[model samples]
Structure formats: C-alpha cells, structure tokens
Target chain A: MDSENLENINQMLEQDAELREKIKDQVTEFDKKTRVMTGLLNKIHSTPTNQLPALLDSVQPVLYSCSDVTAEIADLVPANQFWRWKDTWCNSLRNAVFVATLIEFLRSESLMTIQQVSDILGIQPSWKDRFVLTAEDYLHGVISLVNELSRLAVNAVTMGDFEQPIKISNFVKDIFAGFSMLNLKNDTLRRRYDSLKYDMKKIEEVVYDVSLRKLAPSTRDA
Target chain B: MAEQPQTGSLKSRTAIVVVFETFRNELDEHNDRRERLIKNSRDVTNLSKKVIFLLHRIMTEDEPTPKPNNDRASRAAAKGREKLKEVQNLFASIRGEVEGDRFWRYQRNVSPGLQEYIEALSFAHYLDTGALISFNQVQQSLSDEHGVPYFPLTLEDYLLGLSDLTGELMRYAISAISQRGGRTIAREVCTFVRSCRADFETLTPYYKELRKKQAVTSQSLQKIEDATYAIAVRTSEYDLPPEMLDDVVAMVSGS
Candidate 1:
C-alpha cells in the first residue's frame, strides 16, 4: 500500500509538470498578442487627432488576433480552473478594452457601450461563450479605459485639442456615474474604481486649465 | 422591403442596447452580492480564528483523571458555538444569492473562511465526542444551523480543513508530552494523522495546493512521531532533564 501511494504521488507530480508547461505555452501566446495590441494602442496615443482613423484601422486586425488568443487561453484551461488563471491574462484583456473605448472616443466622442465593445472584438457579451469574454472582463476593460482616458484628456490639451479634454471629462463623468451604480467585489476592479475619483478630478483640472487659457478647440477649428 | 430591413436593423440595435443594459445590471448585482459575501466570510474567518485559539487554550496538558470539567474550556466552547451560529446566519443571508451560477462567483471569497470554520468546528467536535467528525456530519450540521435544505460545503474545503486540523493536533501532542509524559495521546494522534495522510493521497492528484498541504501534514506527523520516540528513549535512559527539554524538542523537530 505504501508503494502504491508512492507511485500515485509520482504520477501526480509528472502530470502537474505537464499541466504547468501547457498553461505556460498558452499564456505566452496570449501575452504576445496583448503586447502587439498594446504597441498599436501606443501608436494611436501619439498620433495626432486627425490621424487616429488610419491608426484605428491598422489596429483592428490586431484586436481580432487578441480575441482569438484570449479564446485559446480560455480553451487551454479547464473551465473549473479558469479562475486560477484569470489573473494571469487580466492585464491583456484590460488593454483590449482600452482599445475598444479608444475607438469609441475617437469615432463617437462618448463612452463605448459594452455591447459595442463586444461587437468590435467579435466576442460574446455573456459567459455563454465559455471560451470567450464575460461581463466582468468587459467591466475590467472599461475600468482600465477610464484610467487611460484621464491621461488622454491631459495629453489632448498638450496636442492643442483643447475641446478633447472637455469631451473626455463629460464622458468619464458619465462612466463614473455608471460605475457607481454597481457594487464592485473583484479586488482589481475595486482598486481601479477608487482611482477613478482621482481620474475624474484630473480630467476636470485639465478642462479647467484649458478654459483658463481660452484654448478651447472652437476658435482654432473655426 | 428595403424599409422593413432598415427598421429591422434599427430594432436590433435597440435590442443590443437593451441586452447590454440587462448585462450591466446583472454585473452590478453580482458585484454587490460578491462584496457582501466576502465581507461576511472575512468576519467568519476572524471569528473562527478566535474559536481556534479558544480550543487551543482549552486543550489541557495533562488531562485530569476525573476531567475536572474546566470551567474556562466550557465557556470558550460556548463562545465558539455562538460565533459559529453567526457564521451560519451570514451564510443564510447569502444563500438566496448563491443559487445557480452565482455560487462560483462567491466561492473564492468564502472558501478560506469556510475552511477555517470547519477546522474550528471539527476541533470542537473532537473535544466533545472524542472522535473525528465526518464530512457528512459537517454538512448536515451546517444545513441544520442555517435551516437550509442544501449546504454548499465543497469536498475540497473539507479535506483542506482536515489537513489543517492535523497541525493543531501536532501542537496538542507536543503540549501534552511536555506536561506529563503523554505517549498515549501522541500515539493516538500519530494513528489519526497517518490515516488522514492516506486518505489525502487520492485527492492530491486533483488539487495542486492539496499536495503541498499533504506534504506539510506528513511533516507534522513526523514531528509527533520523533517527539514520541525521543520521549520514550529519554524515559528509558534517564529522567528527562527540565533544562534539556528545549534542545530535545528542537532536535526532534529538526530531524
């Protein structure tokens, strides 16, 4: 019986090693896609406001690629084990959401609705996709988007798009109101929410600074 | 026909917005439920730790012959029981939300607390009944306490809690031995731990963390074994010197 127990332990150790290797490979692929998507996002960030459409077009394919990689990762881990691995890929998903919101900001000058973001990524909004995105993932993505938009509001003023700060302020205020309606539990989401108040203040200050200088976009566009 | 298709597209867009709104509401509800569950579970974990400390204190070094029925021990046990009842009430409050798919949402938050509470409950049970508490009994008690038909004590939590129980038992054995030559208690603890180690062997394959806990359990069992062995050898050779107790304990634990 002792020998049998030893054999079982040996077998489990071997299986554990194999499982880790398999997960590492999938995570690496997921990381690579996120890095590429983030690179494209940085490019969009630096490009002038008028040049965003072309940059967005270039970034769309990479977004699709990220969705595919995320799907693969969801498949690689057993459904029961997804929670254990969820943290591993959350940053990438957050970045993906940032891109989605950036597209919304660039095109519509409003917060990207979750449905539109899901449509953009070609993923389902519900966990029914099992191997795709869920509402929490989307929320985390939106949370990250809020953080980015606050910085973008400041940067847009530096780029002489003074009206962008005001637009972002309103949009972020709307998002913040929407977030406040929901009680958050996930540690990362809650931490992000706490920072959102500061984001709101930062964007408000940018709008204040722009108005003080009377550098609002209208006269320049006129 | 073209007008119909345009209106159809418009209607679907409205539907998408409606669907997204419902999804958002659901997410908010889930987050609220999850936060409450975590807060309650953390309270349970803290309360259960106090229960554990109480149990540790109640465990006598050289259990008296007539078992003087230590007043302090009984009082501590009663306090532990009351805290457990509060934990049950907390679970009952969340039980409605924990149905269907929502259980997994709160599982991670509540699992640690559940395990700690189980350890406390099982330790209390051993003190009361002088036997290991069965998993089925634990579930039944929880269900009864909450007045719920079904309880969600997962098998993993039960096993993990049982493994933690062994660590407490090891401490008990060491304390008992130091007081008044508790070879009998130590041997009994060894036998119980050995069976637990064997029982966990089958489960180690499914849970990575369980394997680590099992390794710790084995070491705990070994510690008791070596301590008992040293106690026996030292007794046969010479009176256990009070000054050498620390060295003997350190040497036994190290080996």
Candidate 2:
C-alpha cells in the first residue's frame, strides 16, 4: 500500500471538515437572527390583531439580516453540493423559512409560495443552484407554519380576539387539505404531515369553542 | 373592530390549492426518483457482494504460491474482473438519475452501493497486484468509455470502501495461510492491513461512520494476527518439513 494514497484521502477529508466548520459558523449566525425574528413574531400572540402589520414591519430588518447570513452560507457551500452539507444547517434554514412564511401569512392572510420564500431569502428556489432552497424545506416550513398557527389560534382567543381564531382555523384547514393531496413517503415530511392533523384538530376545537359560545361576531369574519 | 377581513375567500382558497398542486407534483417526482435510485443502489450492492464472494472463492480455491505472476492468481483476477463488469453496468445504468446536482441530492441513496463497489474493486486489486487501489484508479473504473465519470466519487465513500477492504483481506489471509507459500502472503496482508489502520486513524474524526468501520478493521487485523501467531507457534514446535507440517496441522485443525 502506498502511504501517499492514504495521505491524499486524508487531505480531502480534512478540507471537507474545514468547509463544514465554516458553514456551521454561518449557520449559527443565521440561527441567531431567526431566533430574534421568532421572538418578535411570538409577540403577535399578545398584540391586538390590528397591530400585526406594525409587528410584521418591525421584523423586516432581522429578516433582511437573516437573508444576508444565508447568502454568506451559500458562498461557503461548493457548487452542486448543497445537499451534501444540508443536514448541518437544515433545521436552521427551515426555522428561517418558517419565520418568513409566518410573516407573509400575517401580512397577507394567505400561504407564502416557495418562490416567495426564496425571494425573501435572496436565494434561488430551483435546485440548479447549490444554494437554492429545496421544496422539502419549503414544505417543512409550511408545516411549521401550520403548527404555529394552531398555537396562535388558542392564544388569539385568550387575547379576546375571537375572529382571529376563526381565520386561523379556516387557514389551517385549507393548508391541511392541501397537504392531504401529497403522496408523502415514510420520511420526516410524512411524520410531520401526520402530526399536522392534530394541529388541525386543535384549531378546529378552538373554532368550535368560539362558535359554541357565540363569542365570534360572525363565523365568516376573518 | 374597524373592519374584519376575510381570509379564506373563494379566490384565496383556489390559489392555495393551485400552489399545493404544484408542490404535490414536485414532491411526487422527487419521491419517485429517490425510490428508483434506492432500488438500483440495492441491486448494485447485491451484485458487488457477489463480486466480492466470487473473488474470495477464486483466490481460496487454489493454493497458489506468492509469486505475482502465478497462473491461478491471474485466472482469479480475470474472473473477478468479469464479474465486476456487471456491477459497473448497474452503476452506469443509473448515471443519469444522479447526474450533476442530483447526485449530491441523492448521494445517501447512492453511497451504500458505491462503497460496496469500492470494497469489491479494492479487494480484487489487492489480490491481483498485492497493493492498495488508488482513489483515482477506482474512479477510473467507474468512468465511461469517454473517461467522464458517471458521477464524481466522494472521498468519504472512497475511504469507507477502503476501510471495508481490510476485512476482506483479513478473511483472504486466514483462508490462504495454510496453503503452500500461504504464510508469506498472510504476513504481507497483515502488514498492509496494519498500515491501512494506522493511516485511517488520523481520518476517523472527520467521518463518524468511518470511525465505526475503523473499529471493525481493528478487529479484522486482530484476527489475522492471532491466526498468523498460532501458525508461527505451531511451525516452531514442529520439526518436520513445511509441507508435511502443513498437512499435520490441517489434520489437527480438522480442515
């Protein structure tokens, strides 16, 4: 056995470890920004529904900084190897996407498309680029959105915002219905999709309670 | 309330459905490709295992001397090469699925088969030339007639596959040790495996799975050392000629 052959392999592996370390640093920075954005978004649960637009506006600076960190992370990844180190930063990226989607939802009261999330993150949505956001990440973000909305539905009622729960219940149900259309394999996405039903049920119960008590002025009100 | 806004209007409801419909098609395509890659990868693994088995069978079937140009060894090498062609074809068939970025996307699906192929290739290489196969050599075998690789070989897979080669070499050494001129080959293999272990130790921290494979490599090296040690002690105790001593030992061991 030539010692040089093993030496070459060792060098390549060392290079990979070094690259991953740099990516991890950027990902940690990205996570910090998303955490701040999440903190700001969490305030939506307490604020009156009329003040959500102001809250969403206030989160824009952190979102832009998060996108900047994402760009730096993207530069660190080699071409055509996004998925190679995807696992290292996948959770943070998903969290960032969830934050973006939630803000979009609060702003427009509709689902944010993958393209929209990509636009906000300043990365391509297509896999042609190594730094692109994948469809799985987008879908996982949407699923997280569903979970967060369910919690928001309960909190909205606690804040004496009866109509907000109705809107959340209807929005969650629509997203859940959309998810049922997907033929998900037995993967993380499938497991998350399975749990989506519980969130849906929880939102439905909130809506059920509001309607039963006649707290909501109109079920048709958003 | 100033004005309660309607969220799930007929327009927005239809829009969400359309968006999800697109996501559905995209996800379904990805899932289908992934499934195909996984099934093909498993097939490759099976064929590579067969190649490994065939090589082992050929090398052990005849007790050839340690000479590099021994006829039985060449014949074994030729037969193993022919069998490995099937495994290579299996890889070539799935080349398009893993082309470009898709390769990285589905690398986990492809890695098991690729590593197994490396193990088989390196084992055959060692048997033929009594040397470790270089990463470039393995990648060369995986390339097309035009010299373009079906997909780039990852360093992780290359190293992992080489680590697995130690186990095969250990088995080969043990099976060959009792044959004519087998002790020399066994010692050569032990040296090679020990060197491989020492080299791979520096890399274990970079790859978690490689660390696990290193543990197995250590075990394989231990087995080879113990077998060679037993043979050495037995030979030292015997006063007969080497051939007669081999027969006596074989009989005592009930082989």
Candidate 3:
C-alpha cells in the first residue's frame, strides 16, 4: 500500500480515539452525579416510610442534573455507534438506572417501566441510530433494585415498621417470579439472576420474623 | 391498614408480570440473533482458512520459483480466486443480519471471521501481484454488485489481518529460498516484509492488540533477514552452481 493510504487509515483511527476520550470525560461526570444520587438514596434504609416523600423530593434536582450530563454524553457519541463506546459508560449508566428505579419504587411502591426509566434519564428507549438505554442495562438495574429492596426490608422492621417488610417480601417475590419467565443465557445477567435468590431469601426471612411475632397490625382494623 | 392498599398492590403485581413478559420477548429475540451471528462467523472463519491453505498449496506445489507471468502462477491465482468465492458468499449471506446499527451491536461476533477473510484475501493478492493489497481494495472486495458495502470495514481488523500475512510471507520466502533459482524472490520478499514492519510500527500505540502482533511481525522479519543473509554469505564465498548452492543453503537453514 502507498504512504498516503496508510496515513489516511491512521488519521481515522486517531479520530476515533479522540472521540472516545471526550466520551469518557462525560461519563465520569455522569458517574459523579449518580454517586450523589446513590448517597441520597442510601438514607432511605434508615428513614421511616412517612419521611420518604421528603427524601425523594430532595433527589429531584440532582436527578435532573444527571440527565443534563447524559445529554452531553449523547451529543458526544456518534450515531449508530452506541455499542462501540458503550463499555466506557455502561456500568455507570446501569447504576443511574438503578437509582431511578429505586426512587420510583419509593415514591409509589411500584416497579418502574423501562420507558419510564428512559424518560427519567432523558435518553431514548429505541435501539436505533441514537443514544439509547439497552434492555440488558434495564434488566441489570432492576436486579440491583431488588438487592437494595431486600436491605430496606430488614431495616424497615428495625424501625418499628413491621408492615413494610410484608410489602417488600410480596413485591420481591412477584419480581422474582417475573424474572423466572425469562430464558436467560449464561452471561452477566444470568449470574446476577442466580444471586437474586439470596436477596429473596433475606426478604422472606424478614417477613417470617415479623409474622411470627404478630407485629403486623390486625387486618380486622380495615 | 386499609383494603385499598391491598388492591393497589395486586394491580401493580399484574403490571409487573406484563412488563416482564415484554422484556422476555425482547431478550429472546436478541439472544437468538446473537447466536446466529456467532455461528455464521465461525463458518466464515473455517471457509477463509481453507482458502488460505489452498492458495499456499497451489502457488508452491511444483514451481521452484514464482514468476509474474508463469503459467502455473496465473493458474494458482485463478484457483485461489475461485475458492475465495465461497468465503465471499458466506459474508454475503450475513449482510442483512448486520445492517445499520446492528453491525456495531454484534461487531465482536463478526470481527474474528472478518479478520481471517482479510488475511486470506490479502495473501492471495500478494501472490498474484507481488505487492501488498490496499485497504480500499480489500474493502471493495467485500461490497455487493451495486458497490454497496455490507458493513464498514474496521481499520483494526484490516491491520491485524495484514500483520498475520507476515507469518505466511515468512514461510513462503524461506521455502522458496531452498529451491533452485529462488534467491531473487527471497531478497524481494525480505524487502517487502521489512517495509511492512516499518510501516506497522507507527500504528502500534493506537491499537492495543496491534502491539502484540507487531512482536510476531518482528520475529518473521528476523527470520527472513537471517535466511537472506546466509544465502548472500554462502554465494559470495563459493562460485558453486545454482542446484548445489540450493542444497547447501537448504542444509544450512534446515528447512
């Protein structure tokens, strides 16, 4: 090959490397915002359920700022090349997703849909020629949400909220049953799914402890 | 402690089930597509390897020295080109599977086979023309009848594949040097390999794996230089006939 041809190839590769460096910078900024949100959410384990609304309200500004950083990341990534640079930011994105899912659950005691998570993160849900949240990332986020909920269940009982454990137990079981319907391959998702049963067992034991002591308020009161 | 909360929980539970059902379908479709691409890539790799082997056999079968216009050399090039059609067909069959954004999604699954195909194609090109194939030429060969490319050719794969070509060239040069009237071809290959190594050195820092492949290229260059130097030394020392010199060089190189 001629010298000009080799020079052109090197130029293209150098451009790709430069773009990656730019994207990585934005991802680091995105990661910093998520860590702040995670620190705020960690307080939910100690706060009583009645006080959760105020805690979630405090996270809204940070979450919006996180979405702003995500926009910067989206602008840096070239079209149709999300998967090429995905490795740089996927773990941080998954953590952001988990934070969003947990906040939604604490606000309404319901699971967040993938579309809703995408809306919160201000990214597209479609896997086309744009920056998008992949299904694998969403699933990983939900698995992490389950893990956090189990920890919440144990701490809720410690705070004299016996009924919260029962709710978390039932919700976790329903989510586990949903995961079972999936035909998972032997990948990172499968390994995470396999470890999910331990979390399920932990939540189940919290429910068992509360029920054995008749700590739940009598249903006749309804 | 209200009946409304129980009903609300039941409603959300059903919503969770429906949402996960949709996720299951999406995951299944993705897994199936990935599996298909992986299988096709393996088939491509196998076919490309056979093409490389076929070219090596045909070009070196009976000729003591390769000539640009030799009847056997042209026949060997023709046979290699014909065999490569099967490898091309394998690539064409998977073109739709990697269309648009999907190409980047499954690029890892496709890269190994694509790199092997590049190696075989460039080696064949070198055998026919006695020169390195250009990147555009390799990319053009992967396009369709209307000149539409199946997917963009990655520069990393093209470079790595060419690095592998040095190994084959080393084998070809050493084998040829042991044959009668093969000294000129050996010196020519030595210069070509040296040029390839010098050019590739500038690219080592940009590609992580290319640095590793560069190590292998250095070894190949060393062997070619050593073999050529031995021949030069022996020829300068003795004015022996070509056939006897061939035996002496062959015995000395142990090839």
Candidate 4:
C-alpha cells in the first residue's frame, strides 16, 4: 500500500510540471503580441491625429492583430481575469491596460493640433493662447482629462491601488466625451465643466473682497 | 439636343471625379499622421506602466530592510536642536555689536520722525527674540562682516530685511499693545494698540474671502496688521491729529 501511494504522488508531480511548461509558452506568446501592438499604437498616437493617415497605412494590420490576440488569449485562459501564480507575467490587467492605451492612442491621433481642433468646434483663436501658452483645442481637451485623472490617481494610490471595473468604464466615457468635445459634438457635453465655471466665479468674488479690505486702512487713514 | 447632352454630362462627371480624388488624398494623409502619434504615445505610456510595475514588485515584494531604533532617532534629533540654538546665539552676539554702532551713527542723520521707525523696529525685535536686538544690530552685522564703518544704507536695503524684523518684533509689539499695562515700554507701545485692534477686525473679511476663493497667501493676512501698524505709529504721541484717529480706527477695523 505504501509503495502504491508514493507512485501516485510522483505521477501527479510529473503531470503538473508538464502543464506548467505548456502554460509558460502561451504566456510568452501573449507577451510578444502585447508589446507589438503597444508599439504600433504608440506610433499612431504620435502622429497629428487628423494628418495621421498621410504618414502610413499601418493601422489596419495592427487593428486586425489586436482582434486576433484578444481571441487567442480568451481561448488560452479560463475566466479571463488574471494570470495564475505560475503565469503572473500575463493577465487580464494587461489586456485592459492595452485596450485603454489604444483608446488614448486614437485620441492623440485625432486631436493633433489645437487650431485644427478649435476650427472644427468654431471658436475664436487668441494669439496669447496659441503663442504664449501653446494651447490648441485638442491640447486643452487632453489637459482636462489629465487633470481629472491626476485627481483620481491620488485617491487610487492611497486606497492601496485597488481599481474596480467602474473606474475603467468611467475612463472610457471621459475619453469618448473628450473626443466629441474636440469635434463638433461638444454642445451638450460642455455642461460637464459647469462646476469649474462656478468655482471660477467664487474665486472672482473672493478676489474682489480681498482688494476692498486691503484698501480699508489707506481709505481710513486718508 | 444631342450636342448639349454630351457636353453637360462630360463637365459634371469631370468635376465630381476631381473633387472626390482630392478629398480622398487629403484624408489619407491626415489619418496616417494621426495614427503614428497615437501608436508612439501609447507605447511610451505602456512602457512607463510596466517599469513602475517592475519597481513596485521589487520594493514591496522583495524582503524589507529593518528600520533603526526610535529612541536613538529622538536623541539624535535633540542633539541637532541644541546645535542649531548654539549657532543662532553666536550670530545674535555678532549681530548686536555690529548693528549697535551703525544704528547709533544713522540715528544722528535722520529726522526725528524717521528716527522712531528704527527705534520701533529695535523695540519690536526685543519683544520677539528676547535677545534685546535693535536696528543698530543690523548695521553692526553688515559693518563687522565687511569691516566697513558707518556706511549709509538705503531705505530699500533696510526694508529688504523686514523678515527678521517681522518674525520677532512684529509679534512682540502687537502683543505688547494688546496687553497695554506692561510699563513705560508698554505705554509707548499702546499708541499702536488701536492699529492692532483694527488689524484683527480687518483680518476677518480677508479670511472669509480666502476661504471662498479656496486660496491663501501670507500677504493677504499681513495686510490687517500692517495697516494697523502704520496708523497707530503715525498718530502723534502728545497730541492727537484732527479726525485722524477716527479715520484710522475705521480703516484698521475694515469697517
């Protein structure tokens, strides 16, 4: 009975080792594709989003590859959430990050220059904003997103870097809204910045009160 | 009728073809550039994310080094405080000898009106640092540092160093004025007491405004006291000016 039990345990160990080797190869393949897609998407983002197609015809291939990779990885892993301890190098987190990154890349490609962006939305351009601040419409839209992100990032870091699916979904919504704002579809979405406008009004009130009080002594002394 | 149909169709077809081709070429160029930038930026962002992940894995997952003892840290901090006090004392002594002589000489040159500003500064310093420092101390520090005697410094030069003066003297004078019962020194300080009251009153609005603005700056808070200081000090000691006190009080109070 003791000899038979030892044989069973050894057989289990051998089977586990073989399974891990197979999983390892799959993870490597996933990693390679992720990197390739990441690189191509980065190039896409670097171009002035509007003039992007003039540079090359590389996007269709990358888009096709992304779709294929997503399918292959889905089949390779069960539950599609995270890499097991043995497969920590590949994960659902990686896939989500990649997809989000592509979304941003698309945004950068479209909103290349503020002037071109501003023209689409039909706003007066100021020389100071263009030359001194170097602000274009697309740039301003990007800044708004970045500011919102940094505000949330601080809280996320303090909360042990835990992220829920809701956070990712919110990011997608914001990115979509931002692109719309860059184009002609901004009228309804413009109300989202109403709070900021309200805050600026409060600032103006305080500044006015400060100047008044500051002059009080001189006024009285005179 | 046959000739008309042919020319009309030819013109329309050529115009349509030309417009479509130009539009297509322009769009192709725009899309290409946009895609490249997006791809490049995404990669950089991804690389940063990966690098951060790698570093975090190293720092948190790797074994941690032990921290030093808290008792030892406290003892070291105490020693540092003592060393700092020693350095400040040394500077104070050197400062006194140098400023005393320089201020004494300048005292002879200024009008009696301006002379009080220097004295007020000295008295204010004494209240603040408990070091019995004065305006003369400032002149002496400069004179001794550079081995120059009685070199006249400009009013701008004097104002530039209002930090050291304000840190200690301003608080001392304001508090002394508020108390109003210390002695002859206190009596002299009381002349400026109205100013302090006015400043405290003025500060309330500024505080509310700052909160409303979601902003805070040192200058705004100091305005109240500075206004009071000017009004109280400017009031004549023996004789009150015509309606000036009422105006000053109103101003200081920010009414």
Per-residue alpha-carbon lDDT of model 1 for A89-171, expressed as tens digits?
66666677777777667777655555566565566444432344566777777777778888888787777778888888877
Candidate order by decreasing lDDT: 2, 3, 1, 4
User: Chain A structural similarity (TM-score) per candidate?
Assistant: 0.81, 0.92, 0.94, 0.38
Q: Which stretches of candidate 3 lie over 4 Å from their true place?
A: A125-127, A219-222, B1-11, B63-74, B239-255
Error of 4 at B101 (Å): 68
Task: Enumerate the chain B TM-scores of all models.
Answer: 0.78, 0.87, 0.86, 0.21
Candidate 4 wrong stretches, greater than 4 Å: A53-60, A66-96, A99-101, A104-222, B1-255
CA lDDT scores, all candidates in order: 0.69, 0.83, 0.82, 0.36
**lDDT, candidate 3, A32-123, per-residue tens:** 98898899999998999899999999988888677787788778777778778788888888998898888877776677777777777887
Model 2, B166-186: lDDT tens digits are 999998899887576688778
State the lDDT of candidate 4 residue by residue for A1-222, as single tens digits.
Answer: 698999999998887576556556655665665566456544533344345454334543443344343444334443423234323433422332333333443344233344443232222333222111122323334434333343333333334332211242234334433433322212433333322222222222222222233432344355
Q: How accurate locally is residue B164 in candidate 3, as Cα lDDT from 0 to 100?
A: 93
DockQ (CA atoms), all models = 0.06, 0.46, 0.48, 0.02
Candidate 2 residue-wise lDDT, A34-110, digit = tens: 88888899898889888988999999888877778777877888887877878888888899889988987777677
Cα lDDT tens digits, model 1, B1-255, are 222222221123333344445666887776677778788788878888888887777666334452433343465566667667777666667777666444655678878888888888877765565456776667776775445633456667877887788898888788767543356667777787777788788778767778999999999999998988886787668676643664576577852
Off by over 4 Å in 2: A125-127, A219-222, B1-11, B62-69, B237-255
Instruction: Report the CA-based lDDT of candidate 2 relative to the real structure.
Output: 0.83
**If you assessed candidate 2 against the hidden native complex, which CAPRI class would it receive?**
acceptable
